[model samples]
Target: MKTAASSVISDNDNTPAQSIPRSPRLLETLLANLDGVVYRCRDDAQWTVEFVSEGCLQLTGYLPEELLLNQRISFLELIHPDDRQMVRAHVDDCVRLRRRFDVEYRIVHVEGAIRWVWGRGVGIYNADGEVEALEGFMQDVTERKEAAQALQEAERRYRSIFENAIEGVFQTTPDGTYIAVNPALARIYGYRSPEDLIVSLRDIRHQLYVEPERRSEFMRLMEEHGSVSNFESRVYRRDGDIIWISENARAVYGDAGTLVFYEGTVEAITERKLYEAEMRHQATHDALTGLPNRNMLHDHLQRAIQSARQKGGLTAVAFVDLDQFKYINDSLGHQVGDELLKTVAQRLMSCVRDSDMVARQGGDEFVLVLQNQTEGDVGIAEVMQRILAAVSRPWQAGDREFHITSSIGVSRYPTDGKDVETLLKNADSAMYKAKEQGRNNFQFFAPWMDTQVSNRLEMLISLRRALDQQEFKLFYQPKLSLKDGRIIGAEALIRWESPEQGMVAPDRFIPFAEEAGLIVPIGEWVLRTACRQNKAWQDAGLPPIPVAVNLSPRQMNQALPEFVANVLADSGLSASWLELEITENVVMKDAEKTVATLNTLKRLGLQISVDDFGTGYSSLSYLRRFPVDALKIDKSFVRDIARDADSAAIVKAVISLAHILNLRVIAEGVEDEEQHAFLRENGCDEVQGYYFGKPMTVDDFTDRLRKEAVQAAP
Candidate 1:
């Protein structure tokens, strides 16, 4: 029953038993009530136990007598195999040095389960200091040790996730300096390692984000709401490539409730942003021409109207329709038609200022919105003129030269309807009016145009019906030799003899025919009829004078030469007995192609002349290049030759120029003796006018040819 303190005092042999402060029985009671074992053992290899307290049963699962004196088991054998050597070495070194020792190790219990223990002991030395015993107190510490191990395992898992996660993770101080960053974050920033990113990017506000204010915004959001989700921004990578990123972050606070740092996850979003932008563009723009489509046009027009209303300025909307586009589409195939539309889109874009917008309303229709026009209709009219000219310019479709024109109708803001739909509708009505007046022109929207649209549509229908009903005729105008005053040739002109409308002039219906694409068939009729009449005259033994047929601008195509040859053959008229008359503008358009066509016609043994010679803006160089046998002076110049000095000079100059080019000159519209004398004195080779004879019927022309043949009898 002796306590270790009392036993040590009694065994000291130096007044210990008498001087002890407490009784051995009392100390032994305290030791028995302790939560651990109090033990004494000899400093031997087995650590032989000399005495052990009753608590030994609880600490090591052994009774005091079982471990005392090594009766059943030595205390050293109780130590776990893994910790035995470390325990022995530490205890022996502390005992040899006469110092206290503290150690922790695992030990085996009576039931075979492992338990962690902490032991504290010191050497009990002999008076001579040569021998000693070891005394120690041992306690089970399994619960605390296991708790520490569990905490360590949780920390390991957290670090693993931080290192290997796909999204970037970071901890940054309030001043924008990185406190800690995972490897994933380093890779996201284009850095070799987290250390590299931390060292290289000192200022996240300026160095990392493309806009420095983004960092400020992020901080503001965190300050206001304590966290941010889907905070999007543009940031710079280490290599300086800009990319989009979205951050989800929280402001981390310390125990004192003060902001410590920001912790966040970042995701790259550049690809998603680009995809959205592409989708937006596709929705607003035309697929074929890359111009704004109707959806965007409405949006633009609405904006323009709003702006014009606010500024008290004018906004003009032009609705454009391509003249005779359907005929071109039907005849040339949709591929060529699509190409022509694309070219026209480009031309239309070039005619306007950058402040204006051009949009494809669909098919052959386009809408232009002109904004902030202080000059009102004057400026709009100028732009419309430019558009008309640009659209009418010659373009190629396949191997053929084509001249297409546009009819434009303009509607003004406040004056025209104020809404988008009304403005567009009014402009459309005006465009139909342009077609009625003659295609290839522009008109301003008037209130009356709404009512006239139906009338125009009816006229178009009637014109189409006329062709099918064979209500067209060819009238011949005699071309007299100015040198001899006799009929040498005739010009074939078309006249529509409608039962409903009576006789219609060429000017009234020819433009509509050209616009509706009926010109090709109508022109063929004229050519065939003229050729047959000339052949009949020759067959009747009348003089075999050449008959000239006028060519429409639309008729001047790669197929024209073959078509004319076919007509000549079908009519049984020799090619030599036929002549083709092309206007100056038609020949000047696509000049290279025109020259090739003229040379082809000449090779077919026919005559070609430049009709209406001085009207078009033709280059003299192109004039020299045109392969024609004659130049017919336009009526405008010939009509005023006797009175207007400018007209007279132009007439004389044209004759001289024609002579110099080895081409004959013919003056038409000569209604007076003075005009005839003026042309004849200028060495004109031929003349055609009312003064000689107006355009007459085929029978009348035939009789006139007969009289000429009789007058020339030898």
Candidate 2:
């Protein structure tokens, strides 16, 4: 009953077979419970199996009887065909060296599926050191091998993207040192390679960014927000050129939640930043003159006002207007006008300090903002005088030399105005006053000027309403024949009877009408009303007399003759009974055109008289060429005739000149009997003043005319 298995165990135990109480079943149970195959094979070419454990069925899909002792198939045949020679060589070398052999290879199952397996073996040797058999353990390890190969593939893909990305990728230490940089990051920073960037750029804060504080700001944002998107900065390249860049980055923390480094992607934005700057410049600067425009001027003025308030200094805003620019543009051409404006712009810029700003307020107007002036008006005045001299210096325009002048008006901050709009508006008002002061000068804004401006604006608004509401009336002042002391004619004067303010003087609103272009309509109303009233008097069986109506400069257009004729026709009055009076300046503004228009009116049988005769620049030659029948002495000369010898001489000379030209001369504003006697003694053709009669209503004049007619009839 003692079989071979028992004998083998008993021989190995020596004296311990009874003492150890060894069981033959203990060896079988240990081998049967293993998850892998345990085998002993002869060290032959076939690796013929001598014993195979029960795990052989699950590991190789073969029963132990089928593999053991080459009963069905040898263990060597169970290995994949491709791995047989390598396995044999490896095991044979280990056996010859008397060392353990460990290997991993492929094996084929009985079902024809390939699986990965690991084998570890040691040689079972005899006392004589002769190779007997190989004993090894083999296991299935296919899942672990496949998992490791997949991880290798993923790593390869990540490395490819990192190397070839367009945007720069980097990992930087928390202290602003580069830990890792891709090839793209190196090229973006103007380096030869990633290794070159790492070696050369040690301090990102000092060596990379143009402004070193940008790096600190970056670190601050990272600490506060844990990430940053679109972090823009100006940085320098290896070639010492500056460029703009934007970064998207986050703090890379270690497993312990402490920040280790920052990982980021950077994009170059130099071109975009440059384009934005250019666009901003274009928006704030003038296209033709290259000066700051109105928009920029407002912004700069606001800042200047604020600075002056804070620093305790004065700021001046000068409004400049080219005096003769309109005439030049109308006569020469807009091309020459544009060239002149450019020249003036340059001259203005040269007149101010670098700290000041000159801006174009559009259309022959420029504004200068002088900042931080300790010398106050004296410094502002000096700069204005320099501007005046520079602008007056003659410059060429299309090969023609011309001399032009500018009128400047200045307003100081915290005095004339405290805000931008108030300052500019006050300056404009002062500019008009400069023009009124005969142009080619500068005026500082006064508090009274602001009151005048406010009053003028209110008057203009009221004037517009007055015309629509028929708040106007005509008063007639009789003109006497000095030779006979008889009422020969009457002058129709306009009066405004306002509901809000009673009896506004003509001096208060007439100038406004002229400037605001409302005079033409008001002048036409006077002409038509005078004509109709004169005709009504004639119809009332009174003596027929001519009524004089004053014409404004704006009303002296070429169509005036037709307009007068239409009025004459509409009122059913003869043109001979209506006289048109124009100021001396109006007639002399454009001599040739004025002569033509006067001739046309004279042909319609209306008499023309030059009013305010001594106040304008009219030469003898132009006066002779004018087709006027009478000249009215200006009130300025008549008022001072007795006191001022110059006034007396001017009046007398005008009388003699008018007579020489065969034109009637009339003296107005003959207030006293002495002035009347002087005018009559000087051979003046007519006289009209307060001494004769003040301006009266139409009914009052008509009654006087009736009384004169009755006296003549008797």
lDDT of each: 0.87, 0.88
* Top candidate when judged by lDDT against the true structure: 2
> How many pairs of residues in model 2 come into backbone collision?
0
Task: Choose the strongest candidate by TM-score.
Answer: 1
Q: Which ten residues in a row have the lowest lDDT in candidate 1?
A: 275-284
**On a 0 to 1 TM-score scale, where does candidate 2 land against the true structure?**
0.52
Supply candidate 2's per-residue lDDT for 189.
87
lDDT of 2 by residue, 1-714 (tens): 556766677878776555543356767888899888899999888899998899888888889999878888888898899999999889999999999999999999989998889999999999999989999999889888888778988888988899989999999898877888899888888999999998999999999999999999998999999999999999988999888999999998899989888998999999768744643454466545768877789889999999888987899999999988989999997557867988999999898889999999877999999998889899888898999999999878667788999999999999989999999988998888788889999999987765566778898999999999999999999999998888999999999999989998898799899889999999988998999999999898888889999999899889999999999999999989988999866876788999999999999998999998755546567889889999999875787676656568667878987998999998898888878878888999999999989999888887888888888785
Off by over 4 Å in 2: 1-33, 37-99, 106-115, 122-135, 172-177, 215-231, 247-263, 287-289, 321-343, 362-364, 392-407, 432-441, 446-714
lDDT of 1 by residue, 602-710 (tens): 8899999988776554566788888889999888677667766756866776787789899999888888899989988889999999998988998888888888888
Candidate 1 segments exceeding 4 Å error: 1-25, 42-77, 109-113, 127-132, 322-342, 394-404, 432-439, 451-714
